[model samples]
Target: MSDYDSGDELLADINAESIVAGTKRDRSESAREVQLSKRPKVEDADFGSTGSNSNDEFVEHIAKTTLKENFGFDQFRHEQFSAIKSILRGENALVVFPTGAGKSLCYQIPAVAFEKIDAAKNGRPHLGSGITIVVSPLIALMKDQVDALLRRGIAAACIDSSKTYEQQQLTTAAIREGRLRLLYCAPERLNNEGFVESMKHVPGGIRLVAVDEAHCISEWGHSFRPDYLKVARFIQEIKAERVICLTATATPRVADDVARAFEIDKSNVFRTSPYRPNLRLLAESVSTKQDKFPKLFKFLREHPGSTLVYVTLQKQAEQLADDLKDEGFHVAAFHAGLKTELKAQIQDDFMASRIPIVVATIAFGMGIDKADIRNILHFDLSGTIEEYSQQIGRAGRDGKPGHCMFYICPEDFYLRENFARGDLPSRQSLRRLLEDLFHRDAVHTPEGDVIKLNQTTLGRTYDIRASPLAILLATLELRFGLIRAITPEYSSYQFEAMYNYYRVVKDDKSQEGKAIFSNAKKAQKWHHIDVNAAARSTGLLRADVIRKLNDYNDRGIILLKASGVENRYKILKELPSTPQEMDAITDKLYAEMETREEDALRRTQEVADLITGDACFALALAQHFGMGLPDGKTKCGHCTHCLTGARVVLPPRPAPSVDMVGIQKILDVCHVRDDPRFLARIAFGIKSPRVFELKLHTKKVLASLEDHDFSSLLREFTKACEAANFGAGTS
Candidate 1:
């Protein structure tokens, strides 16, 4: 959610415009420029006919020729050509191609082809030529895509928080000079008015908009994101010529939601068959938790290649990864709970093939285009069939035979059920949140009229996590327009000197500006200055500081850049008055919660049936994705069902025998929470709050069990906690 790009709306250096703009001409002079002509670059590419019309044919020919020339790809598969053809004709398309079926090429080819058009029309690869904007969900994905594009000589750039302020400025400067034919950015950037304005200002114009993982736009999508909902508005704002949305998995309902949100008609929604020839889908039954690990270890040892092991819980991913690593496998865990740097390192390692195995929660696999992955195993149950399909799609992407298997135990469904039902806020939580916001008004923005509230404060007051908070904010934004906008904080500011150092420092004429600008010349080479630090030291309002700098920027006094965390919405309406009005709002909120819970249940049941059913695995899975089985084909020859010639039966798990000594140790040493499970989780290092509500650095505890072996104690404590809360269930 934090990966949005509006932060790059300003210069990187205090005087970066001069530095960057100064160096732009020489690079152009030193490079060999592409030949420009009014005529299209490739006469061979101007095909008069194919499937649609002259332009489609021409784009198709151009795609084939370019594919061969640049990527040595003499062929286009699935709907790749059709997708490219549609984009070239300025048509909106929804492409649901499988993971390795060249889905990216549908947009990538057009971007490259358009680059040639830009080169032909503008004398270089930029200016007057339209830019293709790619809205990707992940920064890593953005970086990978841009890096690949650059390898092929495509003028690609990405803007995200991952880059330094200086680096972001360089990318923007490159875009300004027509160097960026394809600009990749995260979805959150659309919420930034400044970034939107910059896109509108691009001289080459925004010709095409490509959304990867477009399924996120669907309200009921498995991976639905509030930030994604902003993309439709962004596209509308940009007035992009052609919009293409791509995803590997989209159920009919999801596809419909995507179409409506993106305004893509059903006619242009292109779905390649979800069927893959080289992948053999399989499911194995593990009767008990004990049976699962030994079987997995055996599988890994026998068949070794790049593998992805999916687990339901973050703890499972970490524990399994640790276990596998101890067994001499180069494996690491990936989950949302880990710090960002660690996550990045694990992902990078997996991508570089430095780690042959990665045990991950659902967060790791999306947007990964590794071609040689040999296997994907579901160590835990997937929450939905769509997600399950997407996870397995990661394997066998290179058109080589690969294995896709899921280890199923009947008990898994209960955990998934808890997860789905738990995600939405409870009735009490909803009531509390609504009451808090209604009672507390907002502060006026820097503009002094638009009211705003910090989201972090609301989360703290309500005790809601960020994900649920985003969902709540989005719901309010849609129903009542109450949230106004959500954005990052304004962390830093960039400024250029309005007047020369001597004029400002040596004279009384600019004395008023001297406090903020007094040290401007000493830091002239650095593009960014510490806005918060400046405010702390000079007793200036951050808002006032930014406003003054923006004033300087507007009047050519100085160049200013202010980066916001996210853009929240303006509260267009007042809070409901009276108990009855509040009841009405809460009723609506409760209904939404019920709906999500029901949907979650339905999705979980669907996946469970797919896992436990006796039907042909491939047909059942494909049918869910809206693909029709051939009339004579009732079963896929390669699924776990067909290969094993039987339905998998879950082995009944035996409850672990509680270690009374371990439980007593926890009771003895750990601070007891109202809920004993919290104490157990904390002792086990399983992401629980610190004991006694004391700061971690305090090193104070109700009791100490430092002498205990963590592994034995954790195992026993976990089982005891589960036994205590078997009715409540753990996700």
Candidate 2:
């Protein structure tokens, strides 16, 4: 044993110990990851595939295997593995990732993972899912995903209004038969009676509900969908064990809103870093409209290979496409205003490389998964950083370098602000809606205070669009609990007579049935028998009548279809008794509308700042999404601002001044909404539910302050209140 040999031997032993210690540390880290990933199920059920286990390794193993076998991916990317594992463990997961970060794989892979596991154990794909139901807003997006899923040899389907009833029926059957690993439906599907019934019959069960574009559920989200509000209720109805919410673009507030709405554990809410290194951000200053057109043409000529030219309006898109076409580019226009077939064709052509450039509005790229987009050019401001993120995200998705450029001009604010303001109804519209729908008994009711609305008629009246009116009505329902239950089935029936309904009334064998039929047929059509009316006349219990109707329909005694069904609204809560009470409720809602508009405006201002600020455009935009720039990486060298060392110093915002007498007159005109903030909104001509009802927007009586900027008015009023040191907070 020489000294040199002993030293070498000791060093070898030390290195071996270090290796073992490191492996143990790695194992401990993996265990910690599993422990923190626990998202408890909303209820207990046989997950069938994700057996009861505490091993994170099992979930991770399944995720990797599913990814490779089903999605044909060698490994999970970013948060996909964690999200999928959380879902399979019956834990609620809310995941916010940037677009093209493979958010879809989080749910889609899990859908197949569950099915494969269950099938492997049972030796067959049986009737089961407690299945994965993906609630998406766009039919085209659903179709695209389903098409992709089918291509990957996964069982996936979607039920939407775009399909014929028969086609929807077939799709629904597939869902119920437990053959589908994933099913996509619009949020409106929750309101659909037939679809709801079919979902209830899912043999595998609706164990997991994945809400795509989860940001839509938040009123404060950049894009709010009224239908998204009903999703939580639908999930409750199905008693789903787990929920996984995926959104490509969500701010901190929007992410919090989604997690709270879905009852997902706050700790379980995972967000991928918003920073995308592959994208090169650029901002082009357009001092005039003229500068933008020539610059846009030059950029289009330079950047080729799947370019997206985003404009503010459909007309602008069409004009841009036309001009680009004349400039020798293969360009086509895409906007929601285009027919569905045309939009689909354009999307297809764009994906297949047929269309080199697409001139589109804000509606073009949501849920679109084309990978090779080389450039995205914003012809106008997108009104918000969220909008900008979502739009620019369409480019550089393929892990390839991509360019995103925005042409900024101060003059574009008018159109953008107008678009944001249009979403809010003037206070007058709200008052008229309240008067017609609630207070005045405008709903055609047979008896009692139950408000029965012919939806089409009420919706079309007073020049109110149906969608906006529905949102208002929904707001009333949610805020005040005014609308109790809304059933689209106006009629319920029980019939099983082989002979004519009139003759069936005399059958001794079917005496009670005959009596039921006799009473049901009186004044009411056989197919549209009002359950209450029939049960009352026949002296049978309402519950029994409903049961028999179900039996009869099942037995094919009489072919029952949902052809003439109309919506029936039950009023559980009484209307505001007096005009004063109604006014108060209207005023509160008006404040909400103002907040929504302000949200839009604030987001637009952020985008403006992003373009004009001297800071790295990527860093400014990334931090807007709550992700900090890495240390020592203060400047993103890829941005146009950083590259060119260009900066724009914006002029100081104008100071707001308020006229006390003008404010007092406005308060006198609107006694219900006395909050200084609410008053300020009105002073700036922001729409209000009650003030508009009072016709306060007219030329006289406090309407003269409309010329003031909304933000300034709000700031001045807030300051005035502080100066006076009274009426500080409404609450």
Best by TM-score: 1
Q: Rate the local accuracy (lDDT) of all candidates.
A: 0.68, 0.68
Candidate 2 wrong stretches, greater than 4 Å: 1-54, 119-127, 197-201, 440-468, 484-568, 630-632, 649-731
Question: What lDDT score is found at residue 422 in candidate 2?
Answer: 54
- The runs of at least 3 residues in candidate 1 whose Cα sits more than 4 Å from the true structure, single-residue gaps closed, are 1-53, 115-127, 326-328, 336-354, 446-448, 491-513, 516-568, 629-632, 651-731
Quote the positional error of residue 138 for candidate 1 in Å: 0.4
> How large an RMSD does model 2 have?
15.5
lDDT of 1 at 685: 34
lDDT of 1 by residue, 90-204 (tens): 6789999877677788888887787654443345343356578998987777878789888887788887755554466677777656667788877766655557655655544
Per-residue alpha-carbon lDDT of model 2 for 1-731, expressed as tens digits?
Answer: 11001011011111112222212222233442342233223123333445455245556777788888777788877777777877877689999888878888888877877765555446323334447899888776777889999998887877653443345446555654456678787776565533554454455456678899899888878778776888888887655667899887788888888888888887788888767788899887766666788888888778777899888888999998888888888899998787767887998898899988999987788777788999999888887788888888888878899999888776667566755665666576567767776755535343234565655555444434455666777776665788743434434443334445344334534434654565654334344566667666767654455545544544445544333334445575777767898788889887887787787888888888888987998888777777866664778788988888988554344334656677667656665332455556566655544445566666355435754565566666666556454564533
Error of 2 at 407 (Å): 0.8
TM-score of each: 0.75, 0.72
